[model samples]
Target: MSELDAAVAAALSADGHLADLLPGYAPRPEQQEMAAAVADVINQEETLVVEAGTGTGKTLAYLLPALLAGRRTIISTGTRTLQDQLFHRDLPLARQAVNRPVRTALLKGRGNYLCLYRMERTLESGRLENRALADGLQQVRAWSGRTRSGDLAEAPAAASEPALVPRITSTADNCLGQECPLYSECFLMEARRRAQEAEVVVINHHLLMADWALREGGFGEVLPQADVYILDEAHQLPETAARFFGLSVSSRQLFDLARDIRLEQQREAGDAPGLSEQAARLERATADLRLVLGDGMRTAWRTLERPVGEAAEALAHALAEGIAALAPQAPRGKGLESCHRRANSLYQDLQRFLAEPDEGGQVGWVETRGQGFYLRLTPLDVSEQMAGQRARHGRAWVLTSATLAVDGQFGHFLERLGLDDARTLALDSPFDYPNHALLYLPASLPEPSHPDFAEAYLQEAQTVLEASRGRAFLLFTSHRALQTAADWLARRGHHQLLVQGAAPQQQLLDRFREAGDAVLLGTQSFWEGVDVRGPALSCVMIDRLPFGSPADPVLQARMEWMREQGRNPFATYQLPEAVIGLRQGVGRLIRDASDRGVLMLGDVRLVQRGYGRQFLHSLPPMPLTRDPAQVRAFFADQSSTSS
Candidate 1:
């Protein structure tokens, strides 16, 4: 072996933190090859698209080379859990194994930190002014005394209460910047300063996209100019990038700012003119929205009614005039400035949408979320835009995941990301999936659109639940389907049923764990990144394939975008997306080499439709069975062998 290869081999063989970090527990041949491939890309400064399978040890594959290359690199993940794992666990162990003087820092979005300015504003308001909350704020004040890293996650929490989160959390748009008295010792600023010096900076997709949007543009310059970016869970890239790329504003956010302004005026003893009137105007806007939207709270398209087709035009015009008038009259505080900026941006976006149609222009709707409303005007084609960004950035990019391709082709994903000439490779897992998992597709189920499909699926799901004794998750495509299953299973009352909204996610998972033989039914969020090892999770019942809601304004626009580019949206875009999502859902089962579970895809399309084979090919190699009796028999055989 050459010098670098020998060094890598030595690191691979060295003893480290976990007993699992050695050659005996080394990466399989394909995984080792993947590591070498990534190293080649890092050295050459070329983009690479790698589809490393579930057990490929992709984290170490990228980390070892990133450290070895000694290039300032950024690793972006799809979720916060993986971000924590890389920073707290994997990266540290990799540094030890390599024995390299690699400096690393974990950086999250500004919203993840407690903005002292916003916190003070919140404290002044009765929102967090209670004695218990006052005590919590005091703790943060004390923590600020010693914390070198401004990461709020690092700030000590005496209690893990959800209410305490908002009291201490702040976002960049709402931050006071360098104007505030506490700006010198701000946690958000301090964290960014540390990140400037770190070799490997860990961030999430949302933050990375925010960096591109110039929203958190300040921190990007602080980060060391990088030679490579490794995006894990890269499948979430398109959607997440779209969200940040678009514009958003909300009535709730304006109202919150109004409330904050009222508190600030009282605390600062300022004779601020027009402050009261602006607050009242914001409240009026919020009340108008609430009255128009009515009491409906369903995420479904049929349930939501947008004020469109002339009424929308009129509303858009009125909002534009109102926002323009309110801008000059708004108070000069950071809070009011942010609210005004957001309102003006949102109004302009609405006016643009009202004036334009989907023919060549992008079409979408606006809706209110927690503290804000989003008015998205997505581009008909993002491929060109994404490709342009990748080409402009002088860095080698590695996008890896188990489900980046469908039917052994990266064309769908590559086309979406505009990676036409990028190097692409796939690595297979070493696990013997045929012995580990059984793909159970019930032959008698109706189509997903059938009125009775959910009920029928739930009926069959109960049978599988009984076979596995409730150590399963019934994942639904929609909230309605999930509730239907939860309600049905609740009525059965045989096993402990934990629904998604019934409690906190961690608490529900805890119940599922402690109850041992209970079922936890959830929607899209539960499909991926949920690791329930051993018998606590033995079966995965998928109600149907997760497809983008056809009625969704964004999805419709994307479909039109694909069509405009001379591609069949269903074949090129929608199907491939569904295949990847289904794999992620099924991947929750059989997490380890010794793990065994049954994956029941309640969607009959996997057996009845011609496109079903694509999904099967994308999944891990497993025994495909239609006979329910055989499913039970296989479970019995596995049980007997273990005994």
Candidate 2:
């Protein structure tokens, strides 16, 4: 091994640097192996994909190498929660262990920061809709006066009202940049400046994608300067990249534009008669488009019926006319010019969204949320685009996640990420899964499509909950199923049922933990990123395999495209996706070496179907059982052992 590799190995050793510095630290072979792999990737400047299972200390493994190499490293996480945790917790600890003063900056999307200009405008406009929002704004005003970072997460009142964050933050479309009076003190700009100068930068996948796509100016250029790019929760990259590479225009965006134009006209045009009328026309046109799309409808744009397409085309024409009416007034002032630019941009985006062809590799879809509608053009495959991006950057890339591999193979992830030549490493979690966990696949349950499957699944879940004393997470593939099971469980009064959407996800999790032995029912969101250790979460019941819904516009388009290419969509796309999701769900069972629990898969297909072995193999090694008596015995054994 090289000197650098030896140093990394020693740092990860039992009595090495981290152990000596970190309180209550215990070294593990998996973490050491992952650290060595990361160090090699940094030294060689090669791409590496690693599946460091839960409890492997993957964050520290990657951070140590980056700090030791003293290179500009950009670490991107899947969620802001993880981003904050890394910047505030993991990075500080690693810095302490390494005994190096590495400059680190946490940069989230612009929406997370307070925009003094926007905040002032919002307050001055007297547009506060309610007392709560008004109070939140006042709180933010106070925070803005004192905050050095201007991050909304640090403002308690702003954090309480999530809907108000967007109103107070500046987006790319609306930011006045250097022309604005507040440019000197702009929070987002300062954050970007710090990031550019820092040795390590922490960001979420959204910002990373925006940077890769080169969506903005100065800030978008941060990634190309980094020597190493470490992506935690790497599984989310493919989906996030697809979004960033796509085109989208929303009804809300149009409404916001119209509102801004009116405000600007009042400031610049000084009672501009034609402009106000045109703005109103645009708002009405947007509402008409929303009505045409209707609520809860998601369908491929090419597959939309004639009337809907015609309505969309008509709305696009109205937007064009509105932009034309506003264009001649652009020379008036900065505010009016901003509005004109925004209007023209929105109109062009609408045209592109409506006219863009799928071309066999893209999926064009329209979806409606509440009263708003969105037209989206998403790439069916982002691999080639991502590969082109990687080649252009020529930086050392390290991708790590607990659920990146299937059946100990990285082929699925590597192919999706366009990292065919990347070195691969799979580290089994240090947790004693076989001894501490049991994989309970219930037998004789009806197929998921059967009319009686819901009752049968609920019955089996209740059995598991009974055996585990109501400490369980009942995970369903759809909200409909979650609601059905939640309603059934509530009526039966079997356990303390905490349903998703009853409150915010965090609140639900807090309640679940506090209840100690409650049963929590949730859908896709609960399948991953949820950590509830100890005996409080003794069982996890999955209703069915988490296959992407065939009715979903994006999934349907991708599957159809794969079929046109003579590929088995089920094997190539669907199965692997389901396996990864299942792994995430099952991983919630064993959080630590001492944690013991039962993972109950309610789908009978696991034993009756041939593909069952793939799902079983993808999970952590654990003793399998079909009989409920075995589940009871496992819990009993756990109780006796703990006693």
Candidate 3:
């Protein structure tokens, strides 16, 4: 065996380096296999795609090999929580175990860091209206003095409110870069400097896409050239790439730009000629456009010409006039120059958004939610773009996730990512699923479209909650269904109920764990990345199949595009996406070997529909049943065994 292979094998052995370093470390065969695959990718300098199931210790499996091989690697995760965990917890442990003193750094998007310039300007300009916001700004000011990393996450007051963070952080369009007074100690620049020098740099998917595709101009070249790229939650990459590869313009963005121009004029040129009046005109025009679009209306671009054409054209003209009026302003300072540049950029973007045709593998749509209106031109598929990036980078790419494949095949994922020739691995969970879990597909439920379906599902859910003693996550695919279930359960009053919108997600999870017998009803956000091991969460009840709504403009356009290409949209796109979602939801249960629980899938369509077999085959190997009595008995057995 090669030296790299030998090191990986030794690190995964029962009496290996990790076993000696970590107390109570037990060797897992699946983890060992995954480690070997990762090592081979490093040695051969090739691409690899792996679906390492939950409890497979995949983090350490890849970390150890990267450390042993001594390669400059970039590790990207789906969420900030996991990125922090890998940088602060997992990497430290693995580095110590492998006895490698490698340099590591964690980099997040610009929004996470505090911009001293923006904070000072906002505070000095008296833009904060309320006393609470003023107090929060003072607290942030105090924290910023002592913060080394300047990450807003380290500041308690600023992190508490979502509205305050954006006000204090500098976005790409508004930032003055090195010309700012506080540029010498910029937090984002320092973070990037550290990343460029570190052997292992950790970042989230959005930042990774921005860096890989050069989406943001202000954050120039954040990712250094690396030998290996490891993506942990690799399933989220395709969707994220699609977003970064698209163009978007929002009414809010225009308002913000106009507001910044007014502030800059006030600060630099006291009462600039026609600037203030034009800025106000632009803001008013944007608001007028929003009013015309109305709320909760998502219109296709092709159909928008008649209803929204006049209002949109008016807004575009106002933006162009504003840009022309601001172009002749003298260069007062970097800040004012930035405002002029921003106005010009906004004018260009508005022109493109107004006239860009929805052709050549792209779909255009306009959506309004509450007070915000957005026009987006999204690519139908980003596979070719991603493939080009991969080829240009020519680095060893290692993509691994627990739910990447359906029915033990990576074809769907491979096709979406354009990785047809990449090496593949599927490692099953080491946890004993059949012995510790039960899959309950309740029988005799009306179709999901039926008017009485919600009532029927609740009746069945109540029985399962009674058996499991109210320790369950009632997951729904839609907010309407979630509200229906929450309302019915509130009326029933059998158990303490925690609804999704009642509190923040983290707070609700804390309450659920503390109550120990409460039922939590939530939607898509609660379906994955939740770990409530032991008896606190003993039942996970899914309301129905998580198929994306065909009414969604993006999904609808993609489906039509697939049909136009003579492809089966259901088999190629819809079913695989739902199957992956279902797998993620089910994996929330049985997090560890000793953990036991019951999985209740309320969708009768799993057995009634012809495509249900794929969903069944994709799930972990758990004992299946259709009887309520069987569920009760299984919980009883679990209780007795724990006692």
- What's the lDDT for all of these models? 0.73, 0.85, 0.86
Give the 10-residue window scoring lowest on summed lDDT in candidate 2.
215-224
Per-residue lDDT of candidate 2, residues 1-643 (tens digit): 9877887877787788787876887788788888888899888989999998888989888988888888888899989888998899999988887877989999998888888988887777777679888888888888788999988878875555856766788777788888988999999989999998898999999998887776332344644377888999999899999998888888877887787777778767875778888888888888887877777988888887787877877778877877788778888877678777887888788787777757648878888987888889898898898888777764799998999887888888999879988999999888888888888887878989899999988888877877788989999899899989888989998657899999888889898989988999989888888889888898988999999988898999888888988999999899999999999888888887778998988888888899988998988889999888999999899788878
RMSD (CA, Å), candidate 2 to true, equals 1.8
Error of 2 at 484 (Å): 0.9
State the lDDT of candidate 3 residue by residue for 479-547, as single tens digits. 889998888888987558999999988889999999989899899889887778778899999999999
Q: What CA root-mean-square deviation does each model show from the true structure?
A: 3.6, 1.8, 1.7
How do the candidates rank by lDDT, highest first?
A: 3, 2, 1
- Please estimate how well model 1 matches the true structure, expressed as its whole-model Cα lDDT: 0.73
**Candidate with maximal lDDT:** 3
Q: For candidate 2, what is the TM-score? A: 0.97
Candidate 1 clashing pairs? 250-373
TM-scores of the candidates in the order shown:
0.89, 0.97, 0.97
